[model samples]
Target: TRMRPLMRGGAQERGRRAGTENVPGIAGFGAAALEARSNLEARTAHFLQLRSRLEDGLDEIENVKIIAREAPRAPHISSFIVKGVRAESLALNLDLKGFAVGTGSACASGALEPSHVLGAMGYSASEAKSALRVSFGVQNTEAEVDEFLAALREMTNRNGTLSGRSTSHFTL
Candidate 1:
């Protein structure tokens, strides 16, 4: 239908994209990459540890589906599905409670049309719609993870499920 360069301006990016070279941004990115690469082992271990704690906490929640728990993936992302709740609503609630989370892939257009990632992995449409993508960072602490879990429990349990019904999140 229509096509244009991602960046338009000068002959930057080896004539692929357009736009003048962002020297400072490029330097920052390169520095960050170097730092991350230097700490790859520690970073992976830290994220995996955080992920384990999060998964353990989620395990006690009712009907929470841990997506691809045994599959190969980066240690930082923890994708899951909540039972009887829409992921978008859940993400909003979590945000209100001070946690930033992402919902469906098609949320760009203000629509929560379910995640293609989940669908490709054989999750049902409902499960896909209920998916949340939670990512951990090396700078995050165990206490932060605990705090988020507590907030999650408070949000999910306090307001019930996302089907506009009251649920006792305590036992969940």
Candidate 2:
């Protein structure tokens, strides 16, 4: 493979390595940046409201624990652990039920070890491994958050043990 300069000139980009410009990617990135900057305040408020609702519902579940509940955190993301359930099994079950959830940081997806971030937060290895993350976006609504809350409550209650048998079919 050969490196092609994006601009065929005497010196392009400080005469360093270069390649063909990704026009489409650059355009999409620009569009996204513009959109994000357009209504930033409104988007932040919406995400905060949704996260509040989610946290309230999660609080009613006896076995669920929200990480960093007292610390200031991002309004769009929530991390929690179900006392006796494995995060991977719960995530898969939710996926089958049409909800996408993440078990760990994107950079460490599929890794067997627990998250280092969670460990730094003073969580035990098992608790860190059980962490599940949910994110709220501009496209989400209160109804969707409620539905997700209900589904999570049901799944956690249904299993109710460390047996890790929550992989069974979960309807709704």
* Top-TM-score candidate index: 2
Where is model 2 more than 4 Å wrong at Cα? 1-31, 162-172
Estimate every model's Cα lDDT from 0 to 1: 0.73, 0.77
Across 7-45, the per-residue lDDT of candidate 2 in tens digits comes to: 555564665535656799999999999998998999899
Model 1 per-residue lDDT at 152: 72
RMSD of each: 5.7, 4.7
lDDT of 1 by residue, 1-172 (tens): 5556776667765556777668999999999999979999998998899999999998877778788899898788887788778777777766766678776542332454666666787988888877777888767888888888787776675334743333220101
TM value for model 2: 0.78
Reference-based TM-score of each model: 0.73, 0.78
Error at 56, model 2, angstroms? 0.4
Error of 2 at 75 (Å): 1.5
Give the least accurate 10-residue stretch of model 2, judged by summed lDDT.
163-172
For model 1, the local distance difference test gives 0.73
